[model samples]
Target chain A: MKQFTVHTGTGVPLRRGNVDTDQIIPVRFLTHSSRTGHADALFADWRDDPSFVLNRPEHRGATILVAGTEFGTGSSREYAVWALQDYGFRCVIAPRFGDIFRENALMNGLLALVLPAAVVERLWDLVEDDPRVPITVDLERLRVRCAGVDEPFSLDEEIRARLLSGLDPVMETLGHHEEISDYERRRRPTLPTTTALLDGPLPA
Target chain B: MGSTLAQKIWEAHRVRRGGADDDLIYIDLHLIHEVNSPQAFAGLQARGLTVRRPDLTIATEDHNTPTIAVDRLIQDPAARRQTELLRENCARHGIPLFRLGDPRQGIVHVIGPELGLTRPGMTIVCCDSHTTTQGAFGSLALGIGTSQVEHVLATQTLVMRRMKDMSVTVTGELAEGVTAKDLVLALIAQIGTAGGQGHVVEYRGPAIRALSMESRMTLCNMTIEAGSRAGIVAPDDTTFAYMKDRPHMPQGAAWDGEVAYWRTLRSDDDATFDRETVIDGSRLTPYVSWGTNPGQSVPIEGSVPSPADFADPQERAAAEEALTYMDLKPGTPMRDISVDTVFLGSCTNSRIEDLRAAAEVLDGRRIADGVHMIIVPGSAEVRRQAVAEELDRVFTAAGADFRAAAGCSMCAALNEDRLRPGQRAASTSNRNFEGRQGKGSRTHLVSPAVAAATAVAGRLTAPSDL
Candidate 1:
């Protein structure tokens, strides 16, 4: 995971809600290796449509995705966030996010900012009216600031700490090896014995 | 204070609490598949780590393996390499593997329950999101990332934050033609997909209690769709009966002791949760997706809702956009929607019971003209069971395509099976995102009976319509 503070770029106003991971990076794109070539695959089907906000050249290099409530609601694929990040999105501002997807994005260092529906609507309208309108998301302050509005948001504290420190939860857990080992030694006897119960009874 | 099932299980499994955020909880079962294990195994090798308890870990080739021919797997070199790597890793670590040719080879989620490996009060983790399916038996199951998989491989424990408890209670009985699939779909539609965030949901009430083990698994499988960490049903006689005489289940004297422990896994009547929602299941009809997401759904008899009715203007706009993309007219009854394809088989609804339900609906019917239908079993065992019951003949005679087994086939189009562009499909799978079935292809999530009826009618129709 990369450790870099978020600086929200121009928001791309997508009026759609419940944008699933499948649409972000279709299953076809998942067949390939998980290298850095997936930026093109981000919203592959939608990019072809002339009406899509991201398809417009005016919104090129946009870093903030302002969408409606219940954003990122399907499949628990972390690649959706990866694709958004690779496509230069710094923050996803929505009324709400799918729980697993939010966890995935936050842990992988992508910022998912949730605001009130009214506030999100304002951002959506402002960005839609002018595609070049900028929104600033300061990771340090955990706040989003647009032309007329400024409000604070909160992310899972554990996720925020992990992202800031560039620490993987698994690796961080293993850092205390001595404590884990000692606990295992102390609890060994009471722990259930392993058996190939699929094969037959345990050997006495 | 009264203990909830989650707290009881968590407390029982805790190795130690090292810090404010560090609670080392031991895991009893670790399931792995080809898609996510290679990276974790690679990470382990890089760190010179050996699997702490190889016996506790099990690996299988499911996601990437071609379902048609066991011998023809090498045709796809990339997929072949993944399976080969899984085999090599399991062999190197002395961990047991149930590969493609093995009778035990099936979807990781299906095999775990069928073989009695998933038990009450166990802590189960897998690399796949549907790991919550195991929670049906009163376990605390969840999906973790590759790095966490490697950590579990080396230490047999996971450090995790506890989740708040939320209970969704359903009373009354399911109406005829409604299955567990419909119930879960209705739940998501009502909850809007993110309603259960930051919580562990326990399914309660008489309606949930009446379901079979397979039905319970189907319900828990979609808990992730509702943004819940897991959904559990308290253990009862049905759970024990399902586990009896299975491969890994305790027997003889140990069985009595295990049952005594399992009996205590339920919540006390007075136990409290952080939040609770109640639904009357008797009123729910067969449900289907009408828009892009699972939450964007309606009962079969209801019309597509107009975006203008939305309380949030942004949400209203999104609904309008989804309506445009799906080519659905607001206020149009969902039953009037026509479909060009029908798919029956996914982790969500592809067990033996699902097949039997569809077969019952398709026994003497013929698929409508120009409408394509396909049935891909969830696992080899499910396929074998269907064939033994002659359910495949029922499907084939009904003018439906009976294909060999595969994962994510039509459910995701990850393999060769996909709808042509502009085709509308009635799918017994999860997710109906834009272009999810194929480029420009429209999808409506449905139950097997509904899929079969829609195949015969060439439109979205209820099983009773047949």
Candidate 2:
């Protein structure tokens, strides 16, 4: 994954609240084995309207998504984050996000920024009023700026470090192999393992 | 301060504390299914990494498998290929798998506990969100994403930021006809869908303690809908008895030692929580969601709420849009909502007890003239037990399609079974989001008994209404 320090792009506003992962990329489109080729699957159902925010010509190249509260509220699908990234979105500004979605986003290097609802509402007004408004989201500075409104955002300290440096968590955890091995050894005799022979004598 | 149950499990699993950012937590069990593991395996292969502890991991073919007669080869090329990939990955990595036709095969959450692989004070992780269901055993069961899945596959540990603790104490006893599903739905409606955000909720107090193991699973399973990654109930005699006969449990003196430790898995009397909420379980009725999300539900006796009734503009907008998509009229009695389809199976409510509860309601009477009902058990083991108990005969005799193959079925709509445009349903599944069952499909979340009753009445009817 590439590091994310600062991103500059115009914004599109999706005013609907509780935009769940099921709506982000419906379950029907999750059949492919590979994770790529999901750009069109983002809001595939809603895009049929031709007037939906993502479909509007003015927001075509927008990389920031300003959605209402409780965005990405269902399913633990990583494809939801993949969809946003494939569709060229670098950041999503919402008042709140589902716990798992935010975790997925941070892991995959997509910036799921949470600002106050009032700030997000103002962002919608600014972006909707003028589509050409350029927004800058700086992960290092933890700030988001749009016309007249420059507000600070907060991320979990650990998450901020991962995104700023683009760390591979797996590789990081693998570095502490000795610690894991020690923990495994010290686990209680009562702690069962799937490898134990079925109905076998318990560890003593 | 004394530790809560979640804190105890967290502390036990901690491999090392890393600065102020996160901790390295060892994963006790990693459950994999077809939908999410393919990409993770591919990533592992790309990195020249191998599964560190294949013995501690298990795989199943559930999410997209068909629920038709006795395991016909999956016809959908994509779904079939996904299942095939899982088999190949597990084979190459020496991981054990329960395939589609395996008698032990079922939804990941349902099978883990049945096999005695999910134990108290352990940490469980899966690629699916409903993994919270296993927390009924006093474990910390968390749902993770595919990237995290690959991390755990390569190294049996997950790095974590600290989570706040929450207590949802359900006081008093549940009413006679009410079920665990009803109690959870009522709680979600009281606290919005994102109410439990960033916290691991521990269910306690009298009502929760009185529930059976299956009932506890049913309650914890849907905690994800409220934005909590996990929910847990402390280990008690009920949990011990349920684990005793399961396949992987320790035996003889070892069992005694395990139970003694499990008894200490509860929150200390002086434990403190970041937040707490109390619910009167006796006041809850059968709940049915009228809108898109799980939070937009009302009791069977209540009327649909008007969007204008909301104090916040965001909430009012959400309600208005949900009403539009649901095609429901405000002030209409919830019992009067119509449905052409009724589905009764999911990780949330497809255990043997859930099936029996629905079976009792559908024993003699048939579903209404035009209503279509599908009864798919959570697993093949569950299906076999239902058949042994003759629950299949009851379901089929009641005009419902009792399926032989056991998998996710219409719960996620990854198979041939799904709703078409403009169709409505009363589903016993966890989510009622738009297009969840199928495109343009509208769902009303209900319990098994209510699903059976609604099928008979062709509307959202409760067992009491019958």
Candidate 3:
């Protein structure tokens, strides 16, 4: 995980809503087990079209992605986040995001900011007008400096804290291993366990 | 106030309360497939952690595995590589895996319920969003990402924020020819794609209760399209009856006790939800998507709507974009639009019941000339069962290419089976997203019955239209 505070970058406006994970990185490209080298596959299909937003000359190397509502609206493929980051996007600004995609973004240290639709529209206008318009996403202040507007957005405190410190959630959950074991022991016997169905624990 | 089905299950699985809204919840079942889980396994090795509950975890080679050529070899090198990694990871972790040659191999969601592993009052997690399919059994099933997948593999628990509850109750009865697929499509259209975001939606009411277990699974499977992480149905006689003779069901007293506990997994009448929606089941018709997102749909009898008809600016823009990409003209009757292909597979509607529905429509009639139809079952067992019932004969006789292999075939376009560029399809899959079937491929999501009917007519239509 990469710790983050404030970052300034140009923006690329992806002018479509419900931009799904399948599009961000099509399922066809997801063959190997490895996660790296996905930058070339970002928007694999749309990138070929001359009129597509990302293919435009000016938006290349842009680190901020201003997308429509319901941006990453489908699939739980974390590869989509990797694809965005692989394309050098450190932050994604959308009105809303798919629940799983949003979590993936934050866990990987890519800032996912949810601004009002109106605010997003204004930023899109600014970015479309000038692709070099520097947008500042301040994780510490919980505000975005874009389109000459400083607007506050809300994020869960723990997620913000984790991002600032570059903490891994797995380590945090491991800290409560005792509680997890106790819960497992106290779980109702009726609940189906693989061991119950398979007749003893599987050997690792 | 009494707790809803989701609340009771969440409470049962709560490992510990954190200072934040997030709580650690124990996962009773963890499912993995080839596509989204490889990275998680690699992460586990890097972190020097072993799987804490290999006994509770399961894996299947589904998504990346091609749905053609079973015994010979995996034709695609990339898919073969991915499947090989899954086998290695599962073998190292000691997790049970159902391989391509195994009869049990299938889409993770389809086989979970088929093998009777999915039970009421359980918490299930998978890296795939459609894991909600198991929620039809009253479990609190959710989709997690790779990071969470690795965390669960290592610790068997997830630190997560609680989801708000939303109830989407269906009153009245499903009219003749109206299937769960149609009802769900109508639901998404009514509530938009983001309707169920941040909430666990419970599908209840007399209409839902009347649906078969398979149909209930179909309904719950598409919950992700409505932006919900999970969708659940209360356990009832329908659920129990479906579980009765399955391989994993407990015997004698254990079964009775499990049934008794399952019966109690329903929301109290007085319990309130953060959001509520009601659908008149009688009004639902065969629905299909005309846009890139699942929410952008219309009834089969309706025409493609104009973007100008949208009240929201974003929605209007989306409709415009969809119409351009889909190559659909406003005011053009949906039935009048023709398609070149018909895909009858995906976790959403690839169950035995879906195959039967399509078979029934294709029983004595051949698909239209030049209209290619491919029928892939949800699992090898499903395909075997369909063959026993001679549904495969019906499909093949009707000029459809009925496949013996079972996995996600044309749904995500991960395999060799896909629509050619500029080709349109009436598919029973959950998504109609841009380039889902293939690059420059246009998709119209339909029910199995409607898909069959469309194949017959070479256009989008209902079964009764024939």
Q: Which number leads on DockQ?
A: 2
**Per-prediction interface RMSD in Å:** 4.0, 3.2, 3.5
lDDT of each: 0.80, 0.90, 0.89
Candidate 3 ranges beyond 4 A from true positions: A195-204
Give the number of the best model, judged by lDDT: 2
Question: lDDT tens string, model 2, B385-455?
Answer: 99999999999899999888888889899988899999999999999998999999999999999999999
TM-score of 3: 0.97
Clashes of 1: 0
lDDT of 2 by residue, A15-45 (tens): 8889999999999878878878899999999
Local accuracy of candidate 1 as per-residue lDDT tens digits, B34-60: 766676788688778888888778877
Provide the lDDT at A41 for model 2: 93
Candidate 2 residues lying further than 4 Å off, grouped into runs, are A195-204
Q: What is the lDDT of candidate 2?
A: 0.90
After superposing candidate 1, which stretches have Cα over 4 Å from the reference? A5-11, A55-59, A122-136, A145-149, A182-204, B16-23, B74-81
Ten contiguous residues minimizing lDDT sum, candidate 2 chain A: A195-204
Return the top candidate by TM-score: 2
**First chain TM-score, candidate 1:** 0.85
1 versus 2: better TM-score goes to: 2
- Native-structure RMSD, model 2: 2.0
